[model samples]
Target: MTLHDDAVRVLKDWTAPDAPDGAQEQLRLDYLDHLVSHRDGLWRSCLPAHLTASAVVVDPVQGRVLLTLHPKVGRWLQMGGHCEPEDGTLAAAALREATEESGIPGLRLLGDGGGGPIPVRLDRHRVRCTGRGRPENVHLDVQYVALAPAGAEASISEESLDLRWFGYGALPELTDRSVRELVALARRTTG
Candidate 1:
């Protein structure tokens, strides 16, 4: 199956805990429907809504997370970006982004205890038009958690202004709620 097919299958099969007022649950269903309705929905350039994969990278022993200072958003956020054709699964795409952004290898995804990547969180957020001549779009992000190897040192990439490991209790002020949610989920699952 192609990436789009895999996404459709994954989203359709994924079941999360109760979302407050069932809003998140409804969004998941809607995302699945959007995927089915738009053939190019899985691509980043599709506009309006597209698939993005990201991961909260943690060092389990240290109980800290690695965050990137995104150049465009100017926020300390998780490592992730648009899905590429080479990505075979959402988890793979997330892993790829984590590795690329963190400059860390040998990272392992925390599983949901069902032998699959743990679904840490889901977020739908808007992207600003950053001189790309494209209108603002919505990113339907699939978030996961990756455990970094001990002694893993991160090198800053062009996509980020800085990379740093923040202890859970000392997260930067710029770390958003979505990232905090993902980190909390990761801690619960990995611990």
Candidate 2:
């Protein structure tokens, strides 16, 4: 199946985690609708909003997560970005971003224990995809958790100004609420 087709399938098949406000359910439906309505929804060029893939790399043994200081956003965030044409599936894209950004070999996305590589969370947020003075766009992020091999050491990439590991509870103050929530959800999912 094509990348678009894979995206549609994953969104349709995804079961959003419970939220008090039913926000996740609504967002899941909205993403599914976006894919159905906008054939170009998964690509970065898609206007207004587009799907992005991200993964939080967890070191189960060390109990820490690797985060990148995004150059443009200038905040502590997980490794992820636009899905590329070469990505065959949503899971593949997330894994690729984690591997490329973290520079940690043998990183593997955590699965549902039964179903393969299910996303742990979804975040919709406004971003300045373009440089300064350009109008912002929204990103529909499909988030997952990846496990770094024991003793894994991370190196910086061009995509990030800095890369470091933060304890599950010690996430830097620079991180926003979305990263906090995603890390919590990822931890619970891993447990």
Candidate 3:
């Protein structure tokens, strides 16, 4: 099956208690339906809505999370981005992004043992279309929790201005609510 097909199946089977309400769940279902209905829905350039994967990386021993300073958005956020065609699954995409952006290897998805990559959160947020000259679009983000190996060191990539670990209670002021929510969910899931 194609990556898009896998995404459809994964989202269909996945459930989250932090989905906020019925509307959020409906939005996820709608995203799945959109993926099924459109041939190019999985691609990043798929106009208004497309699938994105991200991770809230944490060092359980340190009680801290690794966040990147996104240059484009000017916010400290989790490591994630658009799904690449080479990604075999949404979980793989999330892991790939986390590893690539955080410069930390051996990070494991928290709930990804044998059942597949279970999302820790589902967030749909609007992103301004500045680079491509397109209008504002929605990123249907599938979020996962990745545990960083103890004593792991992180380096910033070209995509981010800075990368650092922040204590859960001392997150940066620029961090967004969605990111905070993802971190909380990750802590709960791991605990």
Candidate 4:
């Protein structure tokens, strides 16, 4: 199946967590609708908005989470970016991004108790990664949680100015509320 098909399947099967008024449920439906209308919704060129996959790299054993100091956004955030042609599934995309950006090998995604990559959370945020001449973009992010190998050492990549682990309680002040919420959900999932 195509990556778009897989994304539709994953979202269909996922049960959004903590939907007090079905808010998360609404977002899920919106994403499904977006994909239905735009076959290219999964790629970078589909903007003014497109789907993105990301993961919170957590080393629960060490009580820490890895974040990148993004060069474009200039804030510490999770590892993720546009979907690629080689990405077979949304989960694979998230894992690939986490592995690539974290510079940590043997990294595995945290499942939703059913051994599935059902995202821990879904976040939509404005970003300037669309480039200089284009309009601003919205990343309808499918966020997952990835468990890093023991004693994982991070090396900075070109996408980030620095890579570092922060205590669960000590996330930098430079992050947005979405990141902070992602971390909190990840902590509850892993710890």
Q: How does each model score on TM-score?
A: 0.93, 0.97, 0.93, 0.96
lDDT of 4 by residue, 1-191 (tens): 99999999989988888666887888899999999999999999897889999999999998999999998889999999889999999999999999999889998898866767768889888887768776788898999999999888988888899999999999999999999999999999897
Q: What is the C-alpha lDDT profile of model 3 across 9-110, one tens digit per residue?
A: 888887746444576577678888888777788677888888889998899888899999999899999999998989999889999999999999999987
Which portions of model 2 miss their true places by more than 4 Å?
none
lDDT of 2 by residue, 123-165 (tens): 9999989658989999999999999998999999999999999
lDDT of each: 0.85, 0.91, 0.86, 0.91
Give the top-scoring candidate (TM-score).
Answer: 2
TM-score of 4: 0.96
Task: List RMSD in Å for every model shown.
Answer: 1.5, 0.9, 1.6, 1.1
What tens digits encode model 1's per-residue C-alpha lDDT throughout 1-191?
A: 88888878778777765667786677788888889888888786687788788998999899899999999999999999988989998889999999999999999887767768756667898996334676788888988889999999998898899999998878899988888877877777778
**Candidate 3 — what's its lDDT?**
0.86
Q: Give the TM-score of candidate 2.
A: 0.97
Query: How would the candidate models be sorted by lDDT, starting from the highest?
Result: 2, 4, 3, 1
Better of 2 and 3 by lDDT: 2
